[model samples]
Target: MELDHLLRDAVRRLADAGIPSPRADAELLASWVLGLSRGELALKALTGLEVSGADAERISDLVAERCRRVPLQHLTGSAPFRSLELRVGPGVFIPRPETESVVEAVLGQLRRLGEEGIRRPRIVDLGTGSGAIAAAVAAEFPAAEVHAVELSAEAVAWARMNFEVLPDHAAQVTLHHGDLRRSPELLGELSGTFDVVVSNPPYIPADMVPTEVEVREHDPQMALYGGGEGGLELPFAVVAAAEELLRPGGWFIMEHAELQAGPIAEHCAAQPLLESVHTHRDLTGRDRATSAVLARAQRGDVAKWRA
Candidate 1:
Protein backbone atom coordinates (compact mmCIF):
# COMPACT_ATOMS: atom_id res chain seq x y z
CA MET A 1 0.00 0.00 0.00
CA GLU A 2 1.06 3.56 -0.60
CA LEU A 3 2.34 5.46 2.45
CA ASP A 4 -0.46 8.03 2.48
CA HIS A 5 -3.16 5.40 2.09
CA LEU A 6 -1.66 3.26 4.85
CA LEU A 7 -1.47 6.30 7.11
CA ARG A 8 -5.10 7.14 6.45
CA ASP A 9 -6.16 3.62 7.44
CA ALA A 10 -4.06 3.78 10.60
CA VAL A 11 -5.50 7.19 11.51
CA ARG A 12 -9.01 5.89 11.13
CA ARG A 13 -8.26 2.90 13.31
CA LEU A 14 -6.68 5.06 16.01
CA ALA A 15 -9.46 7.63 15.87
CA ASP A 16 -12.11 4.95 16.08
CA ALA A 17 -10.31 3.64 19.15
CA GLY A 18 -10.55 7.12 20.74
CA ILE A 19 -6.89 7.95 20.47
CA PRO A 20 -6.39 11.69 20.45
CA SER A 21 -4.33 13.20 17.66
CA PRO A 22 -4.90 10.20 15.45
CA ARG A 23 -3.24 11.56 12.32
CA ALA A 24 -0.18 12.75 14.17
CA ASP A 25 0.20 9.45 15.96
CA ALA A 26 -0.27 7.54 12.75
CA GLU A 27 2.39 9.63 11.01
CA LEU A 28 4.80 9.23 13.88
CA LEU A 29 4.34 5.46 13.99
CA ALA A 30 4.79 5.28 10.27
CA SER A 31 7.96 7.31 10.53
CA TRP A 32 9.23 4.97 13.21
CA VAL A 33 8.65 1.92 11.01
CA LEU A 34 10.24 3.55 7.98
CA GLY A 35 13.12 5.01 9.98
CA LEU A 36 12.43 8.39 8.47
CA SER A 37 11.71 11.81 9.89
CA ARG A 38 8.16 13.09 9.72
CA GLY A 39 9.25 15.40 6.92
CA GLU A 40 10.64 12.47 4.99
CA LEU A 41 7.46 10.51 5.64
CA ALA A 42 5.45 13.40 4.30
CA LEU A 43 7.59 13.54 1.20
CA LYS A 44 7.18 9.81 0.67
CA ALA A 45 3.42 10.08 1.01
CA LEU A 46 3.30 13.07 -1.32
CA THR A 47 5.22 11.18 -4.01
CA GLY A 48 3.03 8.04 -3.73
CA LEU A 49 5.81 5.94 -2.25
CA GLU A 50 4.78 2.35 -1.68
CA VAL A 51 5.40 0.78 1.73
CA SER A 52 6.99 -2.67 1.64
CA GLY A 53 4.70 -5.38 2.98
CA ALA A 54 6.88 -6.15 6.03
CA ASP A 55 7.09 -2.47 7.04
CA ALA A 56 3.38 -1.91 6.47
CA GLU A 57 2.60 -4.92 8.68
CA ARG A 58 4.79 -3.45 11.42
CA ILE A 59 2.97 -0.15 11.24
CA SER A 60 -0.37 -1.96 11.49
CA ASP A 61 0.73 -3.80 14.63
CA LEU A 62 1.90 -0.56 16.24
CA VAL A 63 -1.33 1.16 15.35
CA ALA A 64 -3.24 -1.69 17.01
CA GLU A 65 -1.29 -1.25 20.22
CA ARG A 66 -1.82 2.51 20.14
CA CYS A 67 -5.49 1.93 19.55
CA ARG A 68 -5.50 -0.15 22.70
CA ARG A 69 -4.56 3.04 24.58
CA VAL A 70 -0.83 2.38 24.85
CA PRO A 71 0.99 5.65 25.31
CA LEU A 72 2.55 6.99 22.15
CA GLN A 73 5.78 7.60 24.00
CA HIS A 74 5.81 4.03 25.28
CA LEU A 75 5.47 2.81 21.73
CA THR A 76 8.25 5.11 20.57
CA GLY A 77 10.33 4.51 23.71
CA SER A 78 11.18 8.19 23.94
CA ALA A 79 9.74 11.51 25.06
CA PRO A 80 10.96 15.00 24.27
CA PHE A 81 11.17 17.52 27.10
CA ARG A 82 12.57 20.96 26.48
CA SER A 83 15.86 20.34 24.64
CA LEU A 84 16.31 16.75 25.78
CA GLU A 85 14.87 13.53 24.40
CA LEU A 86 14.41 11.15 27.30
CA ARG A 87 14.03 7.38 27.29
CA VAL A 88 10.59 6.41 28.61
CA GLY A 89 8.91 3.04 29.12
CA PRO A 90 6.47 1.20 31.38
CA GLY A 91 8.45 1.80 34.56
CA VAL A 92 8.95 5.53 34.08
CA PHE A 93 6.60 8.47 33.90
CA ILE A 94 6.65 10.17 30.54
CA PRO A 95 7.64 13.81 30.72
CA ARG A 96 4.88 16.18 29.66
CA PRO A 97 5.12 19.49 27.86
CA GLU A 98 3.63 21.36 30.82
CA THR A 99 6.68 20.52 32.91
CA GLU A 100 8.77 22.41 30.38
CA SER A 101 7.31 25.59 31.85
CA VAL A 102 8.45 24.41 35.28
CA VAL A 103 11.97 24.14 33.84
CA GLU A 104 11.57 27.60 32.34
CA ALA A 105 10.74 29.03 35.76
CA VAL A 106 13.91 27.48 37.17
CA LEU A 107 15.99 28.73 34.24
CA GLY A 108 14.62 32.23 34.74
CA GLN A 109 15.77 32.26 38.35
CA LEU A 110 19.14 30.75 37.42
CA ARG A 111 19.64 33.44 34.81
CA ARG A 112 18.88 36.18 37.31
CA LEU A 113 21.30 34.58 39.75
CA GLY A 114 23.93 34.69 37.01
CA GLU A 115 23.23 38.39 36.56
CA GLU A 116 23.78 38.82 40.30
CA GLY A 117 27.24 37.17 39.86
CA ILE A 118 26.42 33.64 41.00
CA ARG A 119 28.21 31.83 38.20
CA ARG A 120 27.97 28.18 39.24
CA PRO A 121 24.52 27.84 40.80
CA ARG A 122 23.77 24.58 42.54
CA ILE A 123 20.57 22.97 41.22
CA VAL A 124 18.62 19.85 42.17
CA ASP A 125 15.56 18.08 40.77
CA LEU A 126 13.50 16.28 43.36
CA GLY A 127 11.63 13.16 42.18
CA THR A 128 13.45 13.69 38.91
CA GLY A 129 11.56 10.87 37.06
CA SER A 130 13.32 10.49 33.73
CA GLY A 131 15.88 13.09 34.80
CA ALA A 132 14.32 15.40 32.22
CA ILE A 133 14.61 18.63 34.21
CA ALA A 134 18.14 18.04 35.46
CA ALA A 135 19.45 16.95 32.07
CA ALA A 136 17.83 19.90 30.33
CA VAL A 137 19.35 22.37 32.78
CA ALA A 138 22.82 20.82 32.53
CA ALA A 139 22.54 20.76 28.74
CA GLU A 140 21.44 24.36 28.50
CA PHE A 141 23.54 25.94 31.25
CA PRO A 142 26.86 24.15 31.43
CA ALA A 143 28.10 26.15 34.43
CA ALA A 144 25.35 25.02 36.78
CA GLU A 145 25.84 21.92 38.91
CA VAL A 146 22.75 19.69 38.48
CA HIS A 147 21.60 16.81 40.65
CA ALA A 148 18.55 14.49 40.45
CA VAL A 149 16.99 12.25 43.10
CA GLU A 150 14.50 9.46 42.43
CA LEU A 151 12.81 7.23 44.98
CA SER A 152 11.90 4.35 42.69
CA ALA A 153 14.59 1.92 41.58
CA GLU A 154 12.77 1.28 38.31
CA ALA A 155 12.54 4.99 37.57
CA VAL A 156 16.17 5.45 38.57
CA ALA A 157 17.25 2.77 36.10
CA TRP A 158 15.41 4.50 33.28
CA ALA A 159 16.82 7.86 34.35
CA ARG A 160 20.31 6.44 34.35
CA MET A 161 19.85 5.19 30.80
CA ASN A 162 18.98 8.72 29.67
CA PHE A 163 21.90 10.19 31.61
CA GLU A 164 24.27 7.73 29.94
CA VAL A 165 23.04 8.35 26.41
CA LEU A 166 23.25 12.12 26.73
CA PRO A 167 26.72 12.13 28.22
CA ASP A 168 27.67 15.62 27.10
CA HIS A 169 24.35 17.11 28.15
CA ALA A 170 23.89 15.09 31.31
CA ALA A 171 27.57 15.15 32.25
CA GLN A 172 26.94 17.42 35.18
CA VAL A 173 23.76 15.68 36.34
CA THR A 174 24.39 13.48 39.37
CA LEU A 175 21.63 10.92 39.79
CA HIS A 176 20.94 9.75 43.33
CA HIS A 177 18.69 6.77 44.02
CA GLY A 178 16.95 7.93 47.15
CA ASP A 179 13.93 9.81 48.37
CA LEU A 180 13.88 13.58 47.85
CA ARG A 181 12.88 14.17 51.47
CA ARG A 182 16.24 12.85 52.64
CA SER A 183 18.36 15.41 50.87
CA PRO A 184 20.18 16.24 54.08
CA GLU A 185 21.27 12.61 54.20
CA LEU A 186 21.58 11.68 50.50
CA LEU A 187 23.06 15.01 49.50
CA GLY A 188 24.21 15.94 53.00
CA GLU A 189 26.96 18.39 52.20
CA LEU A 190 24.77 20.29 49.72
CA SER A 191 21.96 20.87 52.22
CA GLY A 192 20.93 24.52 52.39
CA THR A 193 23.17 25.32 49.44
CA PHE A 194 21.25 24.66 46.24
CA ASP A 195 20.61 27.81 44.22
CA VAL A 196 17.45 26.34 42.69
CA VAL A 197 15.35 23.28 43.51
CA VAL A 198 12.63 22.03 41.17
CA SER A 199 10.33 19.07 40.81
CA ASN A 200 7.35 17.53 38.93
CA PRO A 201 6.15 15.31 41.71
CA PRO A 202 2.98 13.25 41.46
CA TYR A 203 0.05 15.54 42.29
CA ILE A 204 -2.95 13.48 41.21
CA PRO A 205 -5.41 12.97 44.03
CA ALA A 206 -5.81 9.34 45.03
CA ASP A 207 -9.49 9.31 44.23
CA MET A 208 -9.27 11.56 41.24
CA VAL A 209 -8.95 8.97 38.54
CA PRO A 210 -7.26 10.25 35.43
CA THR A 211 -9.58 10.41 32.43
CA GLU A 212 -7.06 9.20 29.90
CA VAL A 213 -6.48 5.47 29.66
CA GLU A 214 -2.79 5.93 28.95
CA VAL A 215 -2.33 7.64 32.31
CA ARG A 216 -4.99 5.77 34.19
CA GLU A 217 -3.45 2.38 33.42
CA HIS A 218 0.14 2.65 32.23
CA ASP A 219 1.98 5.36 34.25
CA PRO A 220 3.49 4.17 37.51
CA GLN A 221 1.27 4.90 40.53
CA MET A 222 4.28 5.99 42.58
CA ALA A 223 4.89 8.68 39.98
CA LEU A 224 1.22 9.69 39.87
CA TYR A 225 -0.11 9.97 43.40
CA GLY A 226 0.94 12.80 45.71
CA GLY A 227 -0.36 11.03 48.85
CA GLY A 228 -3.24 11.94 51.17
CA GLU A 229 -6.82 12.15 49.91
CA GLY A 230 -6.16 15.46 48.14
CA GLY A 231 -2.78 14.41 46.71
CA LEU A 232 -0.87 17.42 48.08
CA GLU A 233 1.17 15.62 50.70
CA LEU A 234 4.08 14.68 48.45
CA PRO A 235 4.06 18.09 46.82
CA PHE A 236 4.24 19.73 50.23
CA ALA A 237 7.04 17.35 51.10
CA VAL A 238 8.85 18.60 48.03
CA VAL A 239 8.48 22.06 49.54
CA ALA A 240 10.11 20.95 52.79
CA ALA A 241 12.91 19.29 50.86
CA ALA A 242 13.46 22.48 48.93
CA GLU A 243 13.61 24.42 52.17
CA GLU A 244 16.31 22.08 53.36
CA LEU A 245 18.28 22.09 50.13
CA LEU A 246 17.99 25.67 48.89
CA ARG A 247 20.24 28.44 50.07
CA PRO A 248 18.72 31.52 51.56
CA GLY A 249 17.09 33.44 48.71
CA GLY A 250 17.27 30.42 46.43
CA TRP A 251 14.29 29.57 44.23
CA PHE A 252 11.93 26.59 44.45
CA ILE A 253 9.52 25.56 41.69
CA MET A 254 7.16 22.60 41.35
CA GLU A 255 4.53 21.26 38.95
CA HIS A 256 1.06 20.18 40.06
CA ALA A 257 -2.44 19.65 38.78
CA GLU A 258 -4.24 22.76 37.55
CA LEU A 259 -6.71 22.64 40.43
CA GLN A 260 -3.77 22.65 42.82
CA ALA A 261 -2.60 26.15 41.90
CA GLY A 262 -4.37 28.16 44.62
CA PRO A 263 -3.83 25.69 47.42
CA ILE A 264 -0.15 25.24 46.55
CA ALA A 265 0.43 28.98 46.34
CA GLU A 266 -1.30 29.42 49.69
CA HIS A 267 0.75 26.61 51.15
CA CYS A 268 3.98 28.20 49.98
CA ALA A 269 2.93 31.62 51.29
CA ALA A 270 2.33 30.16 54.72
CA GLN A 271 5.78 28.65 54.95
CA PRO A 272 8.04 30.81 57.17
CA LEU A 273 11.01 30.24 54.88
CA LEU A 274 9.33 30.90 51.52
CA GLU A 275 8.27 34.17 49.95
CA SER A 276 7.37 35.66 46.55
CA VAL A 277 4.79 32.92 46.23
CA HIS A 278 3.35 32.78 42.73
CA THR A 279 1.63 30.44 40.26
CA HIS A 280 2.89 29.99 36.71
CA ARG A 281 0.66 28.86 33.88
CA ASP A 282 1.67 26.50 31.10
CA LEU A 283 1.33 27.17 27.37
CA THR A 284 -2.38 26.40 27.64
CA GLY A 285 -2.71 29.22 30.21
CA ARG A 286 -3.76 26.84 32.91
CA ASP A 287 -2.12 26.98 36.33
CA ARG A 288 0.59 24.34 36.09
CA ALA A 289 3.38 25.28 38.50
CA THR A 290 4.05 27.20 41.71
CA SER A 291 7.27 29.01 42.61
CA ALA A 292 8.66 30.69 45.70
CA VAL A 293 11.95 32.07 46.91
CA LEU A 294 13.47 30.87 50.15
CA ALA A 295 13.41 33.73 52.61
CA ARG A 296 16.94 34.83 53.33
CA ALA A 297 17.84 33.24 56.64
CA GLN A 298 19.38 35.15 59.50
CA ARG A 299 22.16 33.51 61.49
CA GLY A 300 19.77 31.77 63.90
CA ASP A 301 17.14 31.00 61.28
CA VAL A 302 19.54 28.97 59.15
CA ALA A 303 20.52 26.78 62.06
CA LYS A 304 16.91 26.31 63.08
CA TRP A 305 15.80 25.46 59.53
CA ARG A 306 18.62 22.96 59.23
CA ALA A 307 17.67 21.38 62.52
Candidate 2:
Protein backbone atom coordinates (compact mmCIF):
# COMPACT_ATOMS: atom_id res chain seq x y z
CA MET A 1 0.00 0.00 0.00
CA GLU A 2 1.08 3.58 -0.67
CA LEU A 3 1.55 5.95 2.27
CA ASP A 4 -0.99 8.63 1.30
CA HIS A 5 -3.55 6.00 0.30
CA LEU A 6 -3.08 4.19 3.58
CA LEU A 7 -3.42 7.48 5.47
CA ARG A 8 -6.69 8.26 3.69
CA ASP A 9 -8.05 4.83 4.57
CA ALA A 10 -7.02 5.31 8.19
CA VAL A 11 -8.75 8.69 8.28
CA ARG A 12 -11.94 7.13 6.93
CA ARG A 13 -11.84 4.39 9.55
CA LEU A 14 -11.20 6.86 12.40
CA ALA A 15 -13.92 9.23 11.16
CA ASP A 16 -16.38 6.39 10.88
CA ALA A 17 -15.51 5.51 14.45
CA GLY A 18 -16.60 9.07 15.41
CA ILE A 19 -13.24 10.45 16.30
CA PRO A 20 -12.88 14.21 16.01
CA SER A 21 -10.04 15.53 13.86
CA PRO A 22 -9.71 12.20 12.12
CA ARG A 23 -7.18 13.37 9.58
CA ALA A 24 -4.94 14.84 12.23
CA ASP A 25 -5.28 11.74 14.35
CA ALA A 26 -4.62 9.49 11.40
CA GLU A 27 -1.56 11.48 10.43
CA LEU A 28 -0.23 11.43 13.94
CA LEU A 29 -0.65 7.67 14.33
CA ALA A 30 0.93 7.07 10.96
CA SER A 31 3.75 9.41 11.86
CA TRP A 32 4.46 7.40 14.97
CA VAL A 33 4.58 4.12 13.08
CA LEU A 34 6.70 5.66 10.36
CA GLY A 35 9.19 7.08 12.86
CA LEU A 36 8.46 10.59 11.62
CA SER A 37 6.84 13.66 13.04
CA ARG A 38 3.37 14.54 11.75
CA GLY A 39 4.78 17.24 9.48
CA GLU A 40 7.36 14.82 8.14
CA LEU A 41 4.63 12.23 7.61
CA ALA A 42 2.59 14.76 5.60
CA LEU A 43 5.51 15.60 3.37
CA LYS A 44 6.65 12.00 3.03
CA ALA A 45 3.12 10.86 2.17
CA LEU A 46 2.98 13.30 -0.73
CA THR A 47 6.05 11.59 -2.15
CA GLY A 48 4.00 8.37 -2.47
CA LEU A 49 6.35 6.33 -0.32
CA GLU A 50 5.59 2.63 -0.31
CA VAL A 51 4.36 1.30 3.01
CA SER A 52 6.10 -1.84 4.16
CA GLY A 53 3.86 -4.75 5.19
CA ALA A 54 5.12 -4.61 8.78
CA ASP A 55 4.50 -0.89 9.08
CA ALA A 56 1.08 -1.20 7.43
CA GLU A 57 0.00 -3.88 9.91
CA ARG A 58 1.24 -1.78 12.81
CA ILE A 59 -0.70 1.25 11.56
CA SER A 60 -3.82 -0.88 11.15
CA ASP A 61 -3.54 -2.14 14.73
CA LEU A 62 -2.97 1.38 16.06
CA VAL A 63 -5.93 2.74 14.14
CA ALA A 64 -8.12 -0.05 15.47
CA GLU A 65 -7.05 0.77 19.04
CA ARG A 66 -7.82 4.42 18.44
CA CYS A 67 -11.22 3.41 17.04
CA ARG A 68 -11.81 1.80 20.41
CA ARG A 69 -11.20 5.29 21.90
CA VAL A 70 -7.89 4.62 23.60
CA PRO A 71 -6.26 8.05 23.76
CA LEU A 72 -3.90 8.82 20.91
CA GLN A 73 -1.44 10.20 23.39
CA HIS A 74 -1.50 6.90 25.21
CA LEU A 75 -0.69 5.07 22.01
CA THR A 76 2.05 7.55 21.12
CA GLY A 77 3.33 7.55 24.72
CA SER A 78 3.47 11.34 24.83
CA ALA A 79 1.35 14.48 24.56
CA PRO A 80 2.51 17.90 23.48
CA PHE A 81 2.16 20.73 25.98
CA ARG A 82 3.58 24.04 24.96
CA SER A 83 7.05 23.12 23.56
CA LEU A 84 7.47 19.97 25.63
CA GLU A 85 6.15 16.44 25.02
CA LEU A 86 4.89 14.92 28.26
CA ARG A 87 4.75 11.17 28.84
CA VAL A 88 1.18 9.97 29.40
CA GLY A 89 -0.66 6.67 29.76
CA PRO A 90 -3.20 4.85 31.93
CA GLY A 91 -2.64 6.86 35.10
CA VAL A 92 -2.28 10.46 33.98
CA PHE A 93 -4.76 12.91 32.56
CA ILE A 94 -3.26 13.88 29.23
CA PRO A 95 -2.74 17.60 29.18
CA ARG A 96 -5.25 19.14 26.79
CA PRO A 97 -4.53 22.08 24.49
CA GLU A 98 -7.03 24.19 26.40
CA THR A 99 -4.90 23.97 29.54
CA GLU A 100 -2.05 25.58 27.65
CA SER A 101 -3.93 28.87 28.01
CA VAL A 102 -3.81 28.44 31.77
CA VAL A 103 -0.03 28.13 31.56
CA GLU A 104 0.12 31.08 29.18
CA ALA A 105 -1.79 33.27 31.61
CA VAL A 106 0.83 32.50 34.24
CA LEU A 107 3.68 33.11 31.78
CA GLY A 108 2.10 36.36 30.68
CA GLN A 109 1.86 37.52 34.27
CA LEU A 110 5.50 36.58 34.73
CA ARG A 111 6.48 38.70 31.73
CA ARG A 112 4.55 41.66 33.07
CA LEU A 113 6.22 41.22 36.45
CA GLY A 114 9.56 41.07 34.66
CA GLU A 115 8.91 44.60 33.52
CA GLU A 116 8.57 45.46 37.21
CA GLY A 117 11.90 43.72 37.90
CA ILE A 118 10.38 40.64 39.59
CA ARG A 119 12.44 37.97 37.89
CA ARG A 120 12.93 34.44 39.26
CA PRO A 121 9.37 34.15 40.49
CA ARG A 122 8.29 31.22 42.65
CA ILE A 123 5.54 28.95 41.24
CA VAL A 124 3.55 25.95 42.44
CA ASP A 125 1.33 23.69 40.37
CA LEU A 126 -1.42 21.91 42.24
CA GLY A 127 -2.62 18.56 40.88
CA THR A 128 0.28 18.60 38.50
CA GLY A 129 -0.76 15.62 36.40
CA SER A 130 2.17 14.37 34.34
CA GLY A 131 4.08 17.46 35.46
CA ALA A 132 3.04 19.27 32.28
CA ILE A 133 2.51 22.77 33.68
CA ALA A 134 5.46 22.57 36.07
CA ALA A 135 7.86 21.47 33.35
CA ALA A 136 6.56 24.10 30.97
CA VAL A 137 6.99 26.85 33.51
CA ALA A 138 10.46 25.67 34.43
CA ALA A 139 11.51 25.42 30.79
CA GLU A 140 10.15 28.83 29.90
CA PHE A 141 11.51 30.59 32.96
CA PRO A 142 14.85 29.05 33.86
CA ALA A 143 15.18 31.28 36.87
CA ALA A 144 11.76 30.37 38.27
CA GLU A 145 11.50 27.93 41.19
CA VAL A 146 8.62 25.53 40.58
CA HIS A 147 7.01 22.97 42.85
CA ALA A 148 4.32 20.48 41.79
CA VAL A 149 1.98 18.40 43.93
CA GLU A 150 0.24 15.18 42.88
CA LEU A 151 -1.61 12.48 44.81
CA SER A 152 -1.74 9.41 42.60
CA ALA A 153 1.29 7.17 42.67
CA GLU A 154 0.60 5.97 39.12
CA ALA A 155 0.29 9.52 37.82
CA VAL A 156 3.36 10.54 39.78
CA ALA A 157 5.33 7.80 38.04
CA TRP A 158 4.47 9.26 34.65
CA ALA A 159 5.34 12.76 35.87
CA ARG A 160 8.65 11.46 37.16
CA MET A 161 9.37 9.81 33.80
CA ASN A 162 8.77 13.04 31.92
CA PHE A 163 10.82 14.94 34.46
CA GLU A 164 13.65 12.48 33.92
CA VAL A 165 13.46 12.90 30.16
CA LEU A 166 13.49 16.68 30.51
CA PRO A 167 15.93 17.03 33.38
CA ASP A 168 16.97 20.53 32.38
CA HIS A 169 13.37 21.68 32.70
CA ALA A 170 12.53 19.52 35.71
CA ALA A 171 15.69 20.59 37.48
CA GLN A 172 14.00 23.79 38.54
CA VAL A 173 10.77 21.97 39.51
CA THR A 174 10.31 20.10 42.77
CA LEU A 175 7.79 17.24 42.58
CA HIS A 176 5.69 16.34 45.60
CA HIS A 177 3.50 13.26 45.90
CA GLY A 178 0.52 14.32 47.99
CA ASP A 179 -3.06 15.47 47.68
CA LEU A 180 -3.57 19.07 46.68
CA ARG A 181 -6.24 19.50 49.34
CA ARG A 182 -3.67 18.58 52.00
CA SER A 183 -0.49 20.56 52.03
CA PRO A 184 2.36 18.04 52.04
CA GLU A 185 5.08 18.12 54.70
CA LEU A 186 7.36 18.37 51.66
CA LEU A 187 6.31 22.00 51.15
CA GLY A 188 7.79 22.73 54.60
CA GLU A 189 5.86 25.69 55.97
CA LEU A 190 5.94 27.36 52.57
CA SER A 191 2.60 29.07 52.72
CA GLY A 192 2.39 32.59 51.31
CA THR A 193 5.58 32.28 49.32
CA PHE A 194 4.72 31.49 45.72
CA ASP A 195 4.50 34.24 43.13
CA VAL A 196 2.10 32.13 41.07
CA VAL A 197 -0.14 29.21 41.99
CA VAL A 198 -1.71 27.39 39.05
CA SER A 199 -3.61 24.21 38.32
CA ASN A 200 -5.89 22.30 35.91
CA PRO A 201 -7.55 20.28 38.58
CA PRO A 202 -10.28 17.68 38.12
CA TYR A 203 -13.30 19.95 37.77
CA ILE A 204 -15.79 17.59 36.17
CA PRO A 205 -18.73 16.76 38.45
CA ALA A 206 -18.45 13.28 39.96
CA ASP A 207 -21.86 12.15 38.74
CA MET A 208 -21.23 13.27 35.20
CA VAL A 209 -19.72 10.88 32.71
CA PRO A 210 -17.51 12.09 29.89
CA THR A 211 -18.84 11.47 26.37
CA GLU A 212 -15.65 9.90 25.14
CA VAL A 213 -14.73 6.33 26.02
CA GLU A 214 -11.08 7.27 26.35
CA VAL A 215 -11.83 9.74 29.12
CA ARG A 216 -14.57 7.75 30.79
CA GLU A 217 -12.70 4.47 30.80
CA HIS A 218 -9.03 5.17 30.39
CA ASP A 219 -8.44 8.39 32.31
CA PRO A 220 -8.15 7.86 36.04
CA GLN A 221 -11.42 8.53 37.90
CA MET A 222 -9.61 10.51 40.60
CA ALA A 223 -8.26 12.79 37.88
CA LEU A 224 -11.66 13.39 36.26
CA TYR A 225 -14.16 14.59 38.86
CA GLY A 226 -14.52 16.97 41.74
CA GLY A 227 -16.59 16.09 44.81
CA GLY A 228 -20.08 17.46 45.44
CA GLU A 229 -22.44 19.11 42.96
CA GLY A 230 -21.53 21.04 39.83
CA GLY A 231 -17.84 20.05 40.05
CA LEU A 232 -17.11 23.18 42.08
CA GLU A 233 -15.78 21.53 45.22
CA LEU A 234 -12.25 20.84 44.02
CA PRO A 235 -12.12 24.13 42.18
CA PHE A 236 -13.13 25.90 45.36
CA ALA A 237 -10.42 24.04 47.20
CA VAL A 238 -7.95 25.11 44.52
CA VAL A 239 -8.93 28.76 44.96
CA ALA A 240 -8.49 28.58 48.72
CA ALA A 241 -5.16 26.81 48.33
CA ALA A 242 -3.96 29.41 45.89
CA GLU A 243 -5.02 32.17 48.25
CA GLU A 244 -2.94 30.54 50.99
CA LEU A 245 0.10 29.73 48.87
CA LEU A 246 0.50 32.94 46.91
CA ARG A 247 2.43 35.92 48.20
CA PRO A 248 0.73 39.28 48.48
CA GLY A 249 0.14 40.61 44.95
CA GLY A 250 0.88 37.16 43.48
CA TRP A 251 -1.20 35.53 40.73
CA PHE A 252 -3.45 32.48 40.55
CA ILE A 253 -4.27 30.80 37.25
CA MET A 254 -6.54 27.79 36.87
CA GLU A 255 -8.61 25.97 34.25
CA HIS A 256 -12.22 24.97 34.82
CA ALA A 257 -15.26 23.68 32.98
CA GLU A 258 -16.77 26.27 30.66
CA LEU A 259 -20.16 26.37 32.34
CA GLN A 260 -18.55 26.76 35.76
CA ALA A 261 -16.58 29.81 34.65
CA GLY A 262 -18.88 32.32 36.33
CA PRO A 263 -18.99 30.45 39.61
CA ILE A 264 -15.23 29.86 39.57
CA ALA A 265 -14.55 33.51 38.87
CA GLU A 266 -16.95 34.50 41.62
CA HIS A 267 -15.23 32.16 44.05
CA CYS A 268 -11.88 33.73 43.23
CA ALA A 269 -13.27 37.25 43.52
CA ALA A 270 -14.60 36.38 46.95
CA GLN A 271 -11.14 35.44 48.18
CA PRO A 272 -9.65 38.38 50.12
CA LEU A 273 -6.18 37.40 48.96
CA LEU A 274 -7.32 37.27 45.37
CA GLU A 275 -8.61 40.39 43.61
CA SER A 276 -9.15 41.28 39.97
CA VAL A 277 -10.74 38.02 38.83
CA HIS A 278 -10.26 37.80 35.07
CA THR A 279 -11.64 35.14 32.75
CA HIS A 280 -9.59 33.95 29.80
CA ARG A 281 -11.01 32.25 26.73
CA ASP A 282 -9.53 29.25 25.01
CA LEU A 283 -8.87 28.96 21.27
CA THR A 284 -12.48 27.81 20.86
CA GLY A 285 -13.73 31.02 22.55
CA ARG A 286 -14.93 29.18 25.63
CA ASP A 287 -14.19 30.60 29.07
CA ARG A 288 -11.55 28.06 30.05
CA ALA A 289 -9.30 29.76 32.59
CA THR A 290 -9.48 32.35 35.38
CA SER A 291 -6.75 34.51 36.91
CA ALA A 292 -6.82 36.56 40.08
CA VAL A 293 -4.25 38.79 41.72
CA LEU A 294 -3.53 38.77 45.44
CA ALA A 295 -4.20 41.95 47.36
CA ARG A 296 -1.21 44.04 48.41
CA ALA A 297 -0.40 45.08 52.02
CA GLN A 298 -3.37 47.32 52.66
CA ARG A 299 -5.95 44.49 52.76
CA GLY A 300 -6.30 42.32 55.86
CA ASP A 301 -6.29 38.50 55.66
CA VAL A 302 -9.41 37.38 53.85
CA ALA A 303 -9.17 33.68 54.70
CA LYS A 304 -12.38 33.88 56.70
CA TRP A 305 -14.50 34.92 53.70
CA ARG A 306 -18.10 33.66 54.01
CA ALA A 307 -19.43 34.09 50.49
Give the per-residue lDDT of model 2 (tens digit) for 108-168: 8888888889878889999998999988888887788888999999988988887776657
- What C-alpha lDDT values do all the predictions have? 0.89, 0.86
* lDDT tens readout by residue for model 1, 1-307: 9999999999999999988799999999999889999999999999999999999999999999999999999999989888877899998899888888888878888899999999999999999888889888887888888899999999999988887766564557789999887877999888878999999999899899889999989999999999985899999999999988888888989999989998999999988888999888899999989899998877377778657
TM-score of each: 0.96, 0.91
Return the clash pairs for model 1, or none. none
Report clash pairs, candidate 2.
Answer: none
Winning candidate number (lDDT): 1
